[model samples]
Target chain A: EAAVTQSPRNKVAVTGGKVTLSCNQTNNHNNMYWYRQDTGHGLRLIHYSYGAGSTEKGDIPDGYKASRPSQENFSLILELATPSQTSVYFCASGLWGGANTLYFGAGTRLSVL
Target chain B: AQSVTQPDARVTVSEGASLQLRCKYSYSGTPYLFWYVQYPRQGLQLLLKYYSGDPVVQGVNGFEAEFSKSNSSFHLRKASVHWSDSAVYFCVLSLSNNRIFFGDGTQLVVKP
Candidate 1:
């Protein structure tokens, strides 16, 4: 089975506070992604990385930034948290940036006040 | 650009009854389709996927999905559902370069 671990299962941040969500994958996948899940919006991609030291903007990258210091680690950063940014975040790793299965992390529930 | 759509937001079914969840896609080329299930407080799990060849593909937990290029749909089906089958189901479309698009998802409720 694929193993993707995310830190800080639940968090509450005040408005304008900085929030960081971390993810680590044991699958040795080359591609990693960060997505946020909302009630009606489902899951929208926030950021993705092809490999170490690479980050790309996703569908909803307005309020988030991503960093990939290594192949196994990916982090999503919220510079200024807001109430609208409150949602569950998920991290995923795939073998490559192609037609492959994605292994997902448990998820992080964030509440911005 | 590729997109996936799940028409139903929620569906309720009794245990041991059959179930079908609708999914539609908007893509010009051949699409890589997938069905994923998410339980409470957990990440999404792949239930099944379809790339090419046979239209019907089997998945874990006795679930299956049929891909219809004619109608641009990939609907999930189960002959008999159990209470454990209750969860959120998402239909996904994978485009080139590993970019994936997901539907809003359909919540399944199974009553015993």
Candidate 2:
């Protein structure tokens, strides 16, 4: 099974503070994704990377920046955290072709105060 | 625009009853369709996926989904429900570019 690990399971950040959510996958997959889950919007893709040092914007990438320093590490950066950013975030990893089934991490619940 | 839509926001069924969650997509040609289940406080896991071949696709945990290109639908079905099966199910579409789109999701409640 593919293993995706996310750090800081729960976080509280003050308004205007900077926050970073880290994700690491042991499967060595080339594709990694970061998504935010809200009540009605479902899971909106924030950022994704094709491989190391490659980051691409998804549907909703306004306030988020992504870093893929290596094959195993992918990070989501919130330069200026806001109340609207308070939501559960998930990190997933998968290959580029075939079924492209994604393996996900537990999740990180972020609260912006 | 290409998108995925899950009409039912929530569905309640008895533990022993059958279950079906509807999913529809808007796209020109056949795209990769998938059903993902998210347990409480966990990330989404792939339940089933349809790329081509048989319209009826089987997934983990006795779950299955049928794709209808004419109807633009890929509805998930389970013969019998278990209380543990209660979770949020998301319908997803993967375009050729590998950009995935997800629906709002359908929360299934199985009463024991």
Chain B TM (all candidates): 0.97, 0.98
What do the candidate models score in CA lDDT, each in turn? 0.95, 0.95
Q: Of the true interface contacts, what fraction does each candidate have?
A: 0.76, 0.56
lDDT (tens digit, per residue) of candidate 1 on B3-112: 88999999999999999999999999879999999999999999999998999999999999999999999999999999999999999999776779899999999999
Per-candidate DockQ vs. reference: 0.77, 0.67
Question: lDDT for model 2, on a 0 to 1 scale?
Answer: 0.95
Q: Which runs in model 2 stand beyond 4 Å of their true positions?
A: none
Candidate 2 DockQ, CA atoms: 0.67
Per-prediction backbone clash count: 0, 0
- Give the lDDT of residue B23 in candidate 1: 100
Which stretches of model 1 miss by more than 4 angstroms?
none
For residues B26-58, write the lDDT of model 2, one tens digit per residue. Answer: 998768999999999998899999999999999
Clashing residue pairs in candidate 2, if any? none
